[model samples]
Every structure is written in C-alpha cells, then in structure tokens.
Target: MSRASLASLPATPPVLAEFDELLKMRELLLAEPDEATASAVMRRFWDICCGTTDPERVGVLEAAPQYAVLRAFFSVRWGIHLRRLETLASREILADASATDLSAASMLALENYRGIDGELDLLGESPAHNAVVLGCGPFPETLIGLQHSALVGESLTGVDRNHEAVALADAMTRRLCAPRPTVTITHADAEGVDFPAFDLVVVANGLTGKTRLLDRIHRTAPPGVRVLVRNPTLLARMLYDHVDPGPRSGWRVTERRATTALSETLLLERGEHA
Candidate 1:
C-alpha cells in the first residue's frame, strides 16, 4: 500500500533533504514518458533504500545521492515488512504450523527478532534472559520462537486482556513446549496488570496506554531492563515530540527495526537511573 505519512516525514535537515530527493524521483517517475524507465528507476531506488543486511549497514545507503529519499523509502519498506511478520506470527501461533512451512511474512518477523537479538548480543548480553511479552495475541508463535532462541528463558510471562488470546497462548504452550518454562499467560489489561520483574519486556500490537503502561513497568522493573516494542503508531509519534511521562520515566529514542510490510518495530530500553 502507501506510507505517505512515513515517506513524507519531517526530521533532521539531512533527513529532510533525503525526502526532497525522493519527491524529485517520484516526480521524475511520473513525468517520464517511458513506463519501463520509470519502473527501472523505482526498482533501483528500492534496492538502494531497503537492501541493508544489518542496522549498522543501514547508514551506508544514506551515502548515495538523495540519501534521505532512499532512507525514507527503505524505512517505509521496513515498516511494511514488519506488518507482514506480525500477521505471519499470529497465523503460525494460531495454527501451530512448522517453521519450515511458515509464510514469507512469518519468516520476516522471525528475522526481525533475530536481528534485534543479534544487536543485543553485540552489546555483550546473554540470550538466556528473562522476558515479559505484553499483548500476547491469540497466536504468539513469534514469542515461542523467541523462547526457543534463548532470547527468552523459561521465566517468560505473557500478558493480555483477551481471554481467547490467553487460552490460545496457553494451549500453544502445552502443545508445543513441554514442561514449559515459566510461561504464564494472564488475562488482564496491560494498564492494570501486576508486571513481574523481568530483564526484558516486549509490547506488541497494542497502542492504548502504551506510554503509561511503560511508565509503570519502568517504575517496577530494575534498572537496565530492555523494552522491545513493535507498534507502528507509537513509533511514529516518537519521531516528533517526545512523550514525557515525568522524571520517573526516561526513554531514549533507540533504533527501529523492520518487521513486516504494514508495521514498524522499535527497540526501547529504560534508562539505568530512576
């Protein structure tokens, strides 16, 4: 589809310049009398903007002409990739299918998490860490994969308000993972739930009270706990003015990793100090 909101974003001077170039490219594509040439240009643009293997490599694309345009274009592609992954993760969890048979969307989602884990590992952190997943959907196959990857430990607990989602997650745990790790699924709105102390917290697919819930989690969690979020709307908001919940909450804008075609993923870690 279209991500004009993301494509037309207003950011730093460099980012703005990039957007301007993308606009110029779009105009050229529209004005070109030959459709084939326009298509070729578009393809080249996508390759330059969206083909980075890792986050560090992401900046490399910016060195090309119209860097902002290419970066913005790729950012949109990354967002789309994340949405597809979320859908695949949900489907695989609900259906309990083998990973080999997973849809391309699901594969991308898995890759996105792997990328995040890789980045975290590069920071010299252990993968066998405790994590909490908020908004565990009717199918949390992605979370299951995370557990298997050692990105999460048996101490993992998932929270959700929907009974159906909780029941489904529990069922999947019983069927897929035996003597299951400390995977508990609670049916409670994220805003009111009593979150346990976790080394990492994951918030996926929920927008309501995200900041407020994060505030509570920050207050309750120990310093240095990592918070991973994959919400498109929330991430977009962060690009503009900061969302201040007060001194108790200090969040630094981190990286945005690609998940699928319709969604964007963000990695946020709470500050070490209160």
Candidate 2:
C-alpha cells in the first residue's frame, strides 16, 4: 500500500527477520501451506487491528506476496475491527463538531467523498436519484456528500457487511446529512447482498476483490447504470492491488476522475464498454 495510505498506521515497521518469515509464509501457503505460521500471523494481525485505529495496518503482512491472504483476511475482519473502533469513536469523539472526521480513516473517507463531487457534477443532477454505495464503511461521508454536493440523484443507499456499521451510518446520516436527500443504510456482505438496480453504483474504498463487486454491478444493475470503482494508484497498490480487476474482466475504465490522494477513481458503465 502507499505509505500515504498507511498514514494512520504505526510509525515503526517489523524487523527484517519477521518480514522474511511473512514472505516465506506466503510462499509456503501458495505451495504447501503453513498452518502454524498462518495461525500466529493471523493472531498478531487481529491483535493489531483491535488494539489500534490504524486503517490498513501497513506492514502488518510485510510484503506483496501475501497480498491475497491479507486481502481475504481484511475482507472479513474489517467490519469487525472498524466497527469496534467506530463504536468507541462515536462514544468519545464524533458528537463534537471538531471531531467530525473522527480519525485519519474518516478524514480520508470524507475527502474521497468530497472528491467525487466533480464527477457527479459532470453527470448532472436529477430528481429522486437512486444511488447505492458498497463498502460504505463506519462513516457515511461519501453517501452524505454525494447526496448533497453533486446533487447525486435524490435517494442514496449505503451498504456494508457490518450490521453495526450499517446502523451507525443510518444514524449518522439522520444526524448529519442534508434532509433534502433521503438516505438508507443496509447490512449486507458484498459477496452475498441482493444487488439492487441503481442509477449509480459506487464500489467504495476498503472493499476486497473490488473487481467482484464491479462484476456484480454489471450483472444486477440495468444497462447504462453508472459504476464508479475506487482503485489505488501504483503507490497504494500494496494495499489495494488484491481487489483490482484483471484485463479480461468485462468492466472497463470508461473515464478517470480525481479523488482523494489515496485513490484513483474510475468511471465505469454496466453491461457496455465506453
């Protein structure tokens, strides 16, 4: 991942020997497998995820070879860890206007949300707009900004695998988002949710196998439905490469737009190539 993406993580990283172990572990798992090392690494990972507010926990896995395993682990664990952190954040900080950003993660999230305003502006405004955001996360910044700023077509729905996160988003939206645009938050895993037809579908940050959701959008959304996938630049690939789509994947990058410093936002269309 880009060190920038790891901004919230610990200052110091692992030592060389431990780093070597991680790469070897990835190789072993790719070839023969290492339950003992895997178990220990996962334990340490969970410990770090729970103990700190670091978003991506940079160097947690230490190398690109373990990208697949780390991505899979994050896909399942983020909802749990982030929710735990958010619950604490809500109780301690979010109530204060000064802490609206909550943590580095939420700040980055809010920036990403704001960055999309231009693209949505280009798309123009419409009434009673139906939009869906996947991996909406613990905060509703993107949903709220998209709803009010770009005049995102009317109603916005945020989806996440974490039930608490969904509830938190709903509450936050009700508390903070502009009332002119209605929003709904749903609890559903990206892998299994009953994908709804939407005028716009956003595959937000922190979603694993990001291409999977893009492919799903193509399958469930109507023709011409606009899909925006947040991909990382080369610098951030260490953190997001696992979720990127391959060349054969039908979804094409129709247009590129500016987003947060951490991401490369791509405009994509469902069921057709642009």
Candidate 3:
C-alpha cells in the first residue's frame, strides 16, 4: 500500500529535487484526495516522463513519480478500476492506438511490453518455449508479447493469485488473442502453481511475496529450466520489493539486460549442485 520507496542510491541533486517536488504533491493530495484529483496528479508525473529524454537520469526520476502518482490514485482499489485501466491499456496496444490517446494503463502496457521486448535475447539457446508468467495481471501483456516474439514456444501459461485478475485476463486473452489459442490462463498463487514441465518462467515485477516465489521455482520447476525475473531498477525499487540474484539465493544471474530506461530483467538458473 506504499508508493515511492526511498532507494538508497547515490544522490543526484536535481533528481532529488524532483523527488522532493513529488513528495510535496503527494502531501497535498493525501490531505485532500479523490480519484479524479489523484489521476490529475498522475497526469502531471506522466508529462514529466514524456518530457525527459535523458535515459541516464530519467530511469530514476520518471519511474518514481509515476509510481507515486498512481499509488495515490489506486492504493487499495484492486478490482474494477484497476482491471479497467489494465484492460483498456492493453486493448489500446492491441488496437495500435496512437500515443496521444493512451491513458495511464495503456502507457504502462506499452512500457512493460517495450521493456520486455528489449530483453528478448536473454533466452538464447535455452529452449524456453513453454513459458509460465508469474503475476500475470488483468491483460497479460507480457505473455502476449512473448507469444508474438521469438522468446516463447507455441504454448504459454499465465498464473496469478487473484481470481478476479485471473478471470479478467482469461476473458481478455480469449478476446485479444483471436487468431491463435495458445495461451492458457490459470488462477493460482505463485508458490502453489502446479507448473508443468515448462522450459522458462517469467516473474513479473510487483508480485507479492516475490522471494518465496523464487524459492518455489527453484524447487518446483524442471531441471535446467530457465527463470527470468523482471525487476525495476534502482529508482523504481523504492516502491517494490527487491529480489537479489546471487549465490545465497540458489540462483545465478546469467544475463542482465535493461528492460526499460529504469527497469531490468535477469535470466537466471539454479546454481550448480544447489
């Protein structure tokens, strides 16, 4: 229920200044808050992202503000509005809507797709066709893109803990993926998902209880199955839980690729002899 977590990175004074400005805005909104007003605040932050082109700094500055603004708007409303936002955003992408008309949800679908698409090379030589996407939300955009891209196989599976999200994504999948019927959507918690012998598993960002999910994958997935964890970069990590990839976690980071200016994905495998 929190947004804009304090990331412990070395300070960039100007970006820090922007964060302060965001904090001030957050303060005012929290004092007198409503969905419409909070949405307006989100629009201001989105404008900041649109205007800033410097990848080096934009990673930290832009992501933080967007997270803060959206958190203000939809802190606990997890059903209709959130799903609507996701559904519309994804449908716009599928419909090829112009950038000017995209709402916050649509913009997010674009961003997440673009980022995941950029890292498609991470699956190199690893038969990662049968993919299971953890935390598949209302639209399952990542699964859609992966299905279209070369990263996944003929079959794709989406798993989510929320039944509403599962139902919503399933309905969208049936409608969105019209030409093909290769994607399967299931309702299950990340740890308890009865995974088949999949070749790859994609852990989407913002999944609740992420560390335990990783541990479950390590134990439950097939031997040599590759796991990809898409995570927000240092700047956006303030709002989400950070899952480390290294020796202690029984996973080794094989490839680290940037998903967006402010986010990254890592291709990993269980350590040898783990």
Which candidate tops lDDT? 3
TM-score on alpha carbons, each prediction: 0.52, 0.63, 0.72
For each candidate, what is the lDDT?
A: 0.55, 0.59, 0.66
Ranking by lDDT: 3, 2, 1
Superposition error at 216 for model 1 (Å): 1.0
Report the C-alpha lDDT of model 3 over 1-274, residue by residue, as the tens digit: 3433433434446655666556556566657678787667655654554445565775555455345544444333323344566766655544653432223346656666667656677876445658888889877777767766655556788998778678767765665554442888988878787555687888887675678888878777777788888775544454345688668888889888877765678888877534
Superposed by TM-score, candidate 3 places the C-alpha of residue 51 at a distance from the truth, in angstroms, of 9.5
- The TM-score between candidate 3 and the true structure equals 0.72
| 192: Cα error in model 1, Å | 1.3
Candidate 3 RMSD to the correct structure: 6.5
Better of 1 and 2 by TM-score: 2
Candidate 2 lDDT over residue span 1-274, tens digit each: 4324433434334432333443443344445335455445544544443343334444444454444444544434434444455555444444665544434344434455567676565455443258888888667667867766645546788998877778778877776676766788888887675455577877776677676667777677766677777776432444454354445666666677656554667776544433
Whichever of 2 and 3 has more TM-score, that candidate is 3
Off by over 4 Å in 3: 1-20, 43-84, 90-105, 178-181, 194-196, 272-274
Top candidate, metric TM-score: 3
Off by over 4 Å in 1: 1-125, 178-180, 233-249, 272-274
Candidate 2 segments whose C-alpha is farther than 4 A from its true place: 1-94, 97-114, 118-128, 241-248, 272-274
